[model samples]
Target: MFSLFGLTVVPAAAAGGDFAPPGCFGERYGTLFGQGVSVNCFPGEGYGYRVIAHCANGNAFWFVVGEFVPYGFGPAVAECSGALLVPARVVAYEVDEI
Candidate 1:
């Protein structure tokens, strides 16, 4: 379990395969508990990562992977200014360093 911005997150760990950095895994939880979307990135045994969450309300949220468990940004219910902000998809990029 992990916590970010006051919300507890349970990460479903997996391997990102060849396209992503070695041992990197990213997860997207959309419209969490009717609140908003969340994106999490884990380096696992590899390098860092980043996430960009696209929403139905035309808003986009970006989260850079930090050195922690809930290492991303999420539950952005307030950022959309009352719009649904339904998450369309999450794009993740692997950071070879940093």
Candidate 2:
């Protein structure tokens, strides 16, 4: 478990095999409610990483990862709206050549 912006970020159990090349890591966010939720990976660290948002609605989205901004909201890797009850998991990974 990790802490980001006072929010507890919990990572799922590591899958077997090496997550080589693109070093991927993930954090699971609980069900989205109200105005939805915005979460960022690797806060305050400038590292090239791609973000994959897996929604409980069986839909996934991708975001271009970029630099981090202090005292400001970073790019949201995942977002939900309307009456869609979706829990999300944000994965941050570096795309490396094989």
Candidate 3:
């Protein structure tokens, strides 16, 4: 699905590629639930990478791919930038609207 701001590059199930981080190093990219969901990200230092998540409820949740932080609340929108790319990784992202 194509989002107004971001594009849905990969499916929620995730693709078999280098996008998947070896492990959640806190400094490297990691998953939100790390079990059922495909939400991925890395730890944030000066800033967090903003991303759009496709939830099972058909609602899109705004997520930050930095700070090794757990997901926060609500459906949020964020700016698209190259900085959002996980450190030492190259994974495609898929973004969409509610």
Candidate 4:
């Protein structure tokens, strides 16, 4: 669990399975942009992964394997767009084995 602005945020991987942060996996997957949100990436059932963006304003964005990145197995950097009042957090997941 992580904390931001005194709010405790639980990563989506807690519900799915074991997931490592982008840096932990050591590969550049892609980039994410948002505000006031938390992003959680997890391994899916098979040869893919899931990205969940939790927004403060009750908005959620789900990213699949080839949507934002080429393969979906590496590290990613999250950048805030600075357009929305509430920024969202974007997390990229990486797995050692496909």
TM-score of each: 0.28, 0.27, 0.18, 0.27
The residue-by-residue lDDT of candidate 4 on 12-85, one tens digit each, is 54632234555333322323335322233454444543233322223655432322322455533333242345
Q: Give the TM-score of candidate 3.
A: 0.18
Candidate ranking under lDDT, highest first, comes to 4, 2, 1, 3
For candidate 2, the lDDT comes to 0.37
lDDT (Cα) of model 4: 0.38
Model 3 CA deviation exceeding 4 Å by range: 1-37, 52-91, 94-98
The lDDT values for all models are 0.36, 0.37, 0.30, 0.38
Q: Residue-wise lDDT of candidate 3 within 1-98, one digit each (tens)?
A: 55656656544555522233432211123333221223334443333333332222123233333222333322223222222233112233332211
Most TM-score-accurate candidate:
1
Could you tell me the lDDT of residue 90 within candidate 3?
23
Best by lDDT: 4
Which stretch of 10 consecutive residues in model 4 shows the poorest summed lDDT?
A: 23-32
Instruction: State the displacement of the C-alpha of residue 40, model 1, in Å, after optimal TM-score superposition.
Output: 8.2
Off by over 4 Å in 1: 1-19, 32-82, 85-88
Clashes of 1: 0
